[model samples]
Target chain A: MFDTVNLEDARRVIAAAEKKAAAIGQPMNIAVADAGGNLVAHVRMDGAWLGSIDISIKKAYTSRAFDIATKDLATHSQSGNQFFGIHASNNGKIMIFAGGIPLKRDGRVVGAIGVSGGSGEQDHAVAEAGAAAL
Target chain B: MFDTVNLEDARRVIAAAEKKAAAIGQPMNIAVADAGGNLVAHVRMDGAWLGSIDISIKKAYTSRAFDIATKDLATHSQSGNQFFGIHASNNGKIMIFAGGIPLKRDGRVVGAIGVSGGSGEQDHAVAEAGAAAL
Candidate 1:
């Protein structure tokens, strides 16, 4: 059976991420996905960048689909790296960036959280806050 | 300037749609979009079909893009119809079927909601519930 994040869990994670975003003064679009790489919940904070909405959701899917932090994926997907063309796959859903992280349960990846609408460091920080809540 | 649904409005709409989906005994994937056809929020219930995820988001985009229910658009998009090939437009984002409804404010289209993971009728019903909330 596949373990995954539920709606309630997604809400809690989002709440934490929102708090972190507020602290950093960067509005963000946050998204959560289940183990199946299906979106569970998403939120675009007031004043968040509209374009980041799609990126945030797709980042969540990419993290869950690959069960890896997108920051690491970005490193491996650079020009001379093994995953150079991976982003062209997945119908453009693969987001090799710093804002996607897997959510773990009992040391197994159960889902993922993605944050956007800020610099890479800020987005990654917000996602980490959300993932820690899970 | 485009008057559009905000993040708070999207959540209220999603909550109402979820309630209706639960009443109808069907899990659903729901998505809400702004007047600009950008996503504001999306949710997939615990047992919602995974494949419907993309459909739900695209349906919302289609409704907002055309400012019409996909149900009505479907009729006009039938074989040999004027809009028969419209679905092939928008880089394949158009969904000529039920479950999408435009959200109006002061007699103006502002945004839209889309639902999936059930029969077309059920999906339309849920989307109607969401639109009513807006």
Candidate 2:
């Protein structure tokens, strides 16, 4: 059976991330995706621009699809040949950068969460809060 | 506070519709959007062509953004002028067609779900199944 991430879990993750982000005085857009790499939840903070939503989703999608954190993907892409075309191949949704965390339970990836609209370090920190909540 | 649709609700809706479609031997692409018109979930059946994902998402986005079923938007589009350019305006993600249903709870629209990769009528039936589950 496919491992699933449920709503309550996603909400808790998002809430925790939001709290951490608020404490840091950062506004962000967050996105979550299940094991199948489909989106499960998302939020754009009040002051966030609309484009942040797309960036957040792309980061989450890349994390889930590649089964690695997006930061790792960025590193891999830098070492790449075939990976160069991935963004175009995935219809512009696979973003290889920092800001996404793979959600793991029992050493298996269950989903991923991404945060955008802040510096890469801040985004990673917020995403870590979400993953820790999960 | 935002009225959110969780992963459990989205999964149940998608599962119910997938079951119904499988019972009828139909291949489809399904999409779900949260209240804000951003994608919450999507699935493209094995036999479905890749393009169906885009179609399904566009339908769901249109439904959530307009707070009207996609079919109704199609009808409205036919009724005339100002509605014509919406597709272009939304970066080509709005499909005013007969394959999307708004998900409602307590008479308030909670989200929307869409199905494509089949005949419009078939897509509508699958979307209805998803809505019923919600």
Candidate 3:
């Protein structure tokens, strides 16, 4: 198995996401997961929606579990797609939506970040910033 | 809803659980969930079983959702019990196993902790240490 995410990397990702969230004027719940789809770090900004906490973590979990961005999962999980109703599986942990991206190191998936408490486009932008920090 | 769990508390709980796990010579995957059954924090220690990561998080979620210990849930979900086959429901997120316990404050469930990567008794012991931190 590949090396899992460490605390430092997870913190860096969250910090980048937090900066982006602040720049975009949105409070965010950010989550990072290791290659094994286990959470490594998380941050819920004050005034962020409580409901977004789980959504963010599950999105990060989903991204790391599949080694794919959640946006890709969204297409695959759509009606008549190969992974239809995939969200209903995995105890609703599979989030087929935007705002989740995997972090790659030397062409290998090292971890992932998921952002919530903003529009999908905003969340995706912030998550991309986090991934860029990897 | 009441106030959600703070990040400091989650970290403290994990630290306590880690100490207990190390005392027993078992690396562990520890997870904490807020009262709404959402993951707040998680850690998979070095050399911990990868399969236990998701199980630990689900155990925490199940405990918070039901406001009871997973061991109690295990008993209630046994053959001829009222919650028989409960594990198959909730998209298989219900972990009717030991090592999951709620964090209660003033008799109200605030959050939960779950530990894995050892015997059920050992896991339970570690999780108890986590809950005691609350």
Q: Per candidate, chain B TM-score?
A: 0.98, 0.92, 0.96
Cα displacement (angstroms), candidate 3, residue A47, comes to 4.9
Tell me the tens digit of each residue's lDDT in model 3 across A13-64. Answer: 8888889999989988899888877777676775678788888988999998
Full-model lDDT for every candidate: 0.93, 0.79, 0.86
Q: Could you arrange the candidates by lDDT from highest to lowest? A: 1, 3, 2
Candidate 2, residues B1-134, lDDT tens digits: the string is 76756655776888888887887798777877777776665665656645676788789888888888888788767546558667676777889778898999888888889888788888899999999998
lDDT of each residue in A1-134, candidate 1, tens digit only: 87888988999999999999999999999999988887899989989998898899989999988999898899999999999999999888999988999999999999999999999999999999999998
Per-residue lDDT of candidate 3, residues B1-134 (tens digit): 69667767788899999989989899998988877777777777777887888889899989988988998999999999999998998887889999999998888888899888898999999999999988
Q: Model 3, residue A44: displacement in angstroms?
A: 4.6
Query: Highest TM-score among the candidates is held by which one?
Result: 1
TM-score of chain B of 1: 0.98
TM-score (C-alpha, index-matched) for candidate 2: 0.61
Clashing residue pairs, candidate 1? none
> What TM-score, to 2 decimals, does candidate 1 have?
0.95
Q: What is model 3's native contact fraction? A: 0.24
Give the DockQ (2 decimals) of all models. Answer: 0.79, 0.10, 0.25
Worst 10 residues of 3 chain A by lDDT: A38-47
- DockQ-based CAPRI category assigned to the predicted complex of candidate 3: acceptable
The TM-score-based order of candidates, best leading, equals 1, 3, 2
